[model samples]
Target: MKSILKVKNLTMNFGGLRALHNLNISINKKEIAALIGPNGAGKTTFFNCITGIYKPSNGDILISPKGNNEKINGLKPNIITKKGLARTFQNIRLFTSMTALENIMVGCHCVTKAGVIGAILNNKSTKAEERLIIEKSYFILKELGLEIYVNELVTSLPYGAQKRLEIARALATEPFLLLLDEPAAGLNPQETNELDELILKIREQNDISILLIEHDMKLVMSLSDNIHVVDYGKKIGEGTPKEIRNNPAVIKAYLGEEVV
Candidate 1:
């Protein structure tokens, strides 16, 4: 299988404190990969590094959206999104005042071509682009089963629906590789189960690869084709779910602990 994202010798530093040390991870095309570690394990740091939120102190972040390798470390976050890498945050970040449909339309800004002048003039071309964005945003909402909340204010939605809306916004970016940060963070079991099915459906229908950071072991093991474990910013274990479940190091560090 072709690789979609590669982090080689990745490291991060905050002052003299090292957060990540030579960490390496890879996600293949159409694969569902999980990065699981305890809190303060530097998992979010890795996502920030790869998604251009923070430039890595040392190492490379390469993405192959079209089968051609390109280094993305140090690029702006928006540029990275445009490069077919879109991500949701560990915390739900949505426009509280905006409607669900409008929030998703904001995500389309990266892919849209209308400029300030175009918006001011509302020319034929700009109007057409605006219409297309609305149609596409609605389609994404339907895909995520959020069409019912289309005109509702984001803050009016339930917690689970808000979480799904975040993913919907990311999908509106038209990414080839989707990075989900703690997607199951606050979901109830039923919602998490729904999210599990939603994620698999996303991969199958969108033809995209996924790399997620989640603490939900059941979801991780069930959805992931491969799992990478990190502790103290270093990779301590990596394998299939079965291998990871049996790995001594992982058991000592993560799996052994009470999930909640």
Candidate 2:
């Protein structure tokens, strides 16, 4: 399988501190991969580097979109998104005051070709594009089971629905790779189960590869085709779920807690 994302010797530095060190990881096309580690293990830092939130101090960040490989090291976040990589923050970053549909439309902005003149003149092309955005946004919401909150304010939706809305907004970008940061955080047992189903459905239905940073052991073990364990900014283990479960280093570093 061709890897959609590849990171080689990736490192991040914060002044004198090293946040990540000589890290290497990859996500194959349509594969669901998980990045698991203790808190502050630089999981989110790795995501930021891949998504262009921060430029890595060293190494290459390459992405293969539709088998066309390119280096995205210094590209801006929007440029990376346009290159078929989109992500949701660990924290919910939705526009609370905006309607759910409107929030999703924001993601569509990257793909939309409308200019200031097109918007001001309200031409036929602009109108058509507007309609297309609405249709696509609604479709994403429906797929995520967020159709009921389409017209509601983002802040007014239930917590789980709000989390799904964040994902829906990312989906509106039509990414080949989706990066989720702690997506199951703050959810109840039922909500976590639903989220697990939703994630599997996203992979099956959209045919998009997913790379997530999650601490939920059950969800990670069940949903991930492969797991990469990191500790103190370095990878300790990488393998199938069964191998990861039995790996002593992974157990001593992370899974030793409540993970089984």
As a whole number from 0 to 100, the lDDT of residue 189 in candidate 1 is 97
Residue 220, candidate 2: Cα error in Å is 0.4
lDDT of each: 0.94, 0.93
Model 1 clashing-pair count: 0
Sliding window of 10 residues with minimal summed lDDT for model 2: 251-260
For model 1, the local distance difference test gives: 0.94
Q: Write the per-residue lDDT of candidate 2 for residues 1-260, one digit (tens) a residue.
A: 88989999999999988999999998999999999999999999999999999999999999987777799998999999999998998989999889999999999999999999999999999999999999999999899998988899998898889899999999989899999999999999999999999999999999999999999999999999999999999999999999999998999896465664
Model 1 over residues 94-132: C-alpha lDDT tens digits? 999999999999999899999999989999999999999
- Best-fitting candidate, scored by lDDT: 1
Could you tell me every candidate's TM-score relative to the true structure?
A: 0.97, 0.97
Error of model 2, residue 160, in angstroms: 0.7
